[model samples]
Target: MHYCKEMLLIADEMRHFEGFSGALAVSNIEYMGTPNLREKQLSEFLIYSNEKEIVEQQQILFNTLWEKAIPAKQRIKEIELGIKREFAETIRDPTEIRKLFSKLLESAEKDILSISTPNTIKRIEKLGIINQIIKAANLGIKVRLLIDSHTFNEKINDKYGGELAQIKYHKLIKSLQSFVISMIVDESLLLVIDIKDESQENFEDSIGLATFTNIRSTLDIYLSLFEKGWHQSE
Candidate 1:
């Protein structure tokens, strides 16, 4: 019981500790379905203290792994500061961009602020982002949307009418002219896509290359723009 409990504890520790990737090697140990940790037959512990070759080989492997693993504390700091490397991925393909947007929305913890054109709104709704936005609102996540719509036309009003009151805040800024579609999650990750023309036959076909990043400076710029535009919108 003690040995089995120890292994389970180690696994839990590894989930929070990034500095180590560990494995337990038990000789001739076999199990079916859920392991019965109380079995007496699992008593023997393997030790290689006297085996020089086996110990030396394992030492080399351990050293290699330790060099490659990032420290748990360092990883925590990176996440807190929004400095993870994966946060800077550039997605160009239309399908992939939509997929990533959904993922970002799903993972958002606090809030979402977005600026969209009529075209982008339709595309995102078609891609199921509307449902995720509704879910986020239901979970108490603040959702603010600023649209470049001058009038309450059917294109922008009909689809989003039901959820307008559900979101934390939304504004219609018809005077703002822009071809860019931008979404920010929790004031951290930002996604921007440039549209060449809104009247294109396919939404995906009209999209140009875009990038997503959590860089602090870039985030500040987008936040400022959103705040300014939000204040000016009705």
Candidate 2:
């Protein structure tokens, strides 16, 4: 009962945090699923105020997760004692996290939406995942993607490797990033996996992800991180 309650609280936190402009993939023109609270305008807990902080912030956060929260020994003790720990502190196994992520990708059978603010790095991030989504879509599933606020090749500059770094995804409906926020709905689930490595070779690098069987039960921290990243990029 506690676990289920915590899950629902997380989902609500995620939904109310990000100010997605409008329904880009699955909502009506007027109702954006992420809400309309801008970061600058709204007073909320901020993990990182800039996109450049992703690496350092995430690194430190993950590395000290156990220390910051209940220690692994404590977690195991609680579990052994039959106490309900909503999140198991010990990395006793990676299997649980991996399985959840797999299910997230697997759940696209109904509706899957990938929304990102257009930029060389983040756009490239979406490109790496889109093909998989498309393949999933072709299997009689519905898959839609949106990249917002992308301007021109000149914006990226050749110094950063030009189009080589900029154009990662083969296809997407490029437009104002703000207008694409609301399109995400009908999504019983959402996956916001940050590929930190940024190398085409080891695309398997996963920075973080929000995995859930029901979007209504996913943690809001995931969307909060997304909004944090999205705002920093802009």
Candidate 3:
């Protein structure tokens, strides 16, 4: 259906072509119409109020929304080109972090690079995340893992021998005191887990915070560090 003549005329005449750029206060609400008002019935209705109180309230709401909104042109361009919105999220819940990690691994198309402490590795192994990594490797995804040398022992070898064999690359580096697990998927997404208490064996209890991001600049910084560590690893 075409827009009403009044709306079309206003859109054409306004200096701010986008509705959001104008000073006009607009409120949208759902409405049910009676039989007498059936022609005006709409699942959603826009309201323009002349009362000072209502206008002030709506202006405040509009300002709040405006601050959060991006330019309409940018949004339109993103939609047209099918661009994924960039985001960085800090996930505190262990379950949610695990879910995000698994989802990223499952969606990996080319490669996976990971740096992990032995304790962190062991914890995730218990959570079945290690199995997912092994599966990705089996599917021909390039998987490179870096772990500390001191903790890389007979026990870890015994547990991960078959699984590690399937991975494309594995290296041992000097012992790191920090309890952390970092993984980059397809050179796009990064997941970093900070371990609060290494003494705790469970993934939930040990992890302090998890950061997930696909921001290009952040990915580049980490990727450089990963490459440096990877080249230096044995």
TM-score of each: 0.59, 0.30, 0.69
Cα lDDT, model 2, residue 9: 57
Q: Please name the candidate that would achieve the greatest lDDT relative to the true structure.
A: 3
Ranking by lDDT: 3, 1, 2
Show the lowest summed lDDT stretch of 10 residues, model 1.
26-35
Question: Residue pairs in steric clash, candidate 1?
Answer: 149-174, 150-174
**Candidate 2 residue-wise lDDT, 1-234, digit = tens:** 344345555563212111224221121122112324353375343332234444455445434542445444455456569975443122223345444444555655565545544442344334343344445555656544444434223333332343233222223332323312222223544434433333333323433333333334343443443445445545
Error of 1 at 221 (Å): 0.4
TM-score ranking, high to low: 3, 1, 2
Candidate 2 lDDT score at position 189: 42
lDDT of each structure?
0.69, 0.39, 0.71
User: Which portions of model 1 miss their true places by more than 4 Å?
Assistant: 1-87, 150-153, 168-176
lDDT of 1 by residue, 1-234 (tens): 344345555664322324332342322232112223234455333343335565556566556665655554455556778876434657778888767878989999999998887677666666667788888998889988887454324554576776655675445465554888888999989999888778764667768877899988999998998888788764
